[model samples]
Target: MIIFMQLRVNVTEFCIDFNCMKIPSSLLGFFNEIGAASRFVSRYFQEVVQPRYEVKQFIKQCFLIGYRSLPLIGITGFIMGLVLTMQLRPTLIAYGVVSKLPVMVSLAIVREIGPVISALIFAGKISSSMGAELGSMKVTEQIDAMEVSGTNPFKYLVVTRVLAATLMLPVLSVLSDAIGLYGSYLGVNIRDHTSLSLYFFEVFNTLKFGDVLPAIIKTFFFGFAIGIIGCYKGYNSSKGTEGVGRAANSAVVISSLMVFIIDLITVQITDVLGLN
Candidate 1:
């Protein structure tokens, strides 16, 4: 009987310990989210190739996502170049190599800063907007209603936005780079004298196919990341009104993180391929 009672106590203790053990809720939730996002991406690929392409919606999205974003991107790009040039001027002047300022600034902006910064800004504006728009539709049962009406909402919505972003980012990056170079020209003339033609000459002379191509190519991935993350977060959102805000915030955060990751990977690949 004593032995039986001791066994009962041990079982009770084990049950208590098991009950007291804490679950890794946050970690589990993160992994679950990752899985969900992966599945969403896979589904996108599958649906993208199917018939009944939404060509009209795709063009409309391109105009909205690309054309609407240009002014802000151009202004930011110009300021970035001007500020970067001004900041680097002193250092270059100290070394008496201030003439190399255009080359250095041009390479830095084209190879790294321009695409990444433009992408981040795009993410901040576009990703959050997509998330909020879709999340609102999700909460209001519009996405569901579309399904009931035999409309493929994901095709009309997610595919178009993603394609628009993917195609337009490279175009935006090109414009941003040009505007930035012009800003750098203005900056160079602030404390030094360099003609517009000379400034562009130095820029073009320094840039190569390797420098320009990889930079432009990566912007496509950056755009894809931003669009996909936004759509994924917004489409999967729950919790009604609160979910819209959460979706938008998460879209920006994740998309920004993705941009950095893709940039790093691209740099590594470029290094290996001797493109850098």
Candidate 2:
């Protein structure tokens, strides 16, 4: 009986030890992922700012990531504006603020929706693409070859992609804002006719420099966050094809979350500054 009881106690201890190991293991895994990503981004910034910049590659990536991404972003922008207007019509009409719709809608789009939505679209297209491309390069030994050749693979690949994304996202957001506003016009005209001049006048009239600048400025950070996170994930991807998918997935997830987080802080700062 004493031996049997001792055996049972040993088994119970084993089970408890097994369960306890999983919690720490899971926690460690999470922290490892965070640390790896943070280090990669820091490395990217350092490499990107160094001399001997890769201008040609940067331009090539711009065309690839930015130009190639326009079609999807434009469509999304149009739909976003049109849908927002459609959805808000009933609310505005009920409140008898239908005539105020142009300025209201424009403010909503420009001050908030335009940058955030555009960034999200950019995160989906540019970030994921950058991650997958770099991940594939990493897994296929292209990155290793560059390293073997004494070419700074991080600078060549990561910097180029991040810089392209940083520059292009602001430009893309500007275009999206314009397109979305136009969509808002169409939304307005569906119920009542308003000239472009009047629509824009009301828009500009309601908007202050404060409203415009902060929104635009935050987009730059958004772009940078997306680019760095995506490239870091891909550049450090594991030595297998599966790593490509993981990098791309992680890029989108991290960048999207970062956008919202940054946007929240931006809004708070802007509000504290009394822009609203």
Candidate 3:
């Protein structure tokens, strides 16, 4: 009873002190923005789950957000693989494991680097685009108009973008992994002679379901996190044109951080599961 009363006193004193302290206008604005974003994200999921699936809009978003983003991801993935292989070659040669280059590079790319690099590219492109587009719509009060017209803006806008990112990222990752491996192949050939069959066979032999599944699974989470955070930032944007810029910038920053965080968690889980 005494301990409980002391705890209550501490809590009361803390609240009193907090209330008595002067909160900077900037800090208050920050809290308000965070609250708005939290509410928006919660509503976004709820709105997404309701009846009336927006299939056509979803597909359109998939094309705009996912299909359009592919070229960038592809180019980045290829360069990533090519560069990684080239950079690592000297070290492998030093170890007299130059012939093992294809296998090692392929496994490294597939297991960790490819998906991560691709996702970062996706985040830079898609998250910023989502934020700016939605933020602009918000600023123009188009989103409000939709709501007033009995259209669920969250369902129509947020769900489609998030779902598109979620669905297409896996497909993109598969392509990126394949292309990255090909780049590694070319990188291998630049300084050495290895047949396509030999290079790919080595890649496949070294790569198991263990390596593939965890990496693939983590990308889904990465995509979802990026999409949701972007949508949340945009949907909750305020202060007109300035807010749009801030939203876009914040979306990319937050989404990229979340991707790395998810990657770390994935590595831990994979290790615990003995998947790698």
Relative to the true structure, how large is the alpha-carbon lDDT of every model? 0.92, 0.85, 0.87
Give the alpha carbon lDDT tens digit for every residue of 102-190 in model 3.
88888888888988988899999999989999999999999999999998898999999999998888879889989999999999888
Better of 2 and 3 by TM-score: 3
Model 2 agreement with the true structure over 77-137: per-residue lDDT tens digits: 8888888888898998999988787778888888899999999999998889888999999
Model 3 residue 159 distance off true place after TM-score fit, in angstroms = 0.6
Greater lDDT among 1 and 2 belongs to 1
For model 2, the local distance difference test gives 0.85
lDDT of 2 at 119: 98
Candidate 1, position 103, lDDT? 93
Best by lDDT: 1
TM-score of 3: 0.89
Which pairs of residues have clashing backbones in candidate 1? none
Pick by TM-score: 1 or 2, better one: 1
Order candidates by TM-score, high to low.
1, 3, 2
Off by over 4 Å in 3: 1-17, 21-38
Off by over 4 Å in 2: 1-23
How many Å off is the CA of 96 in candidate 1? 0.9
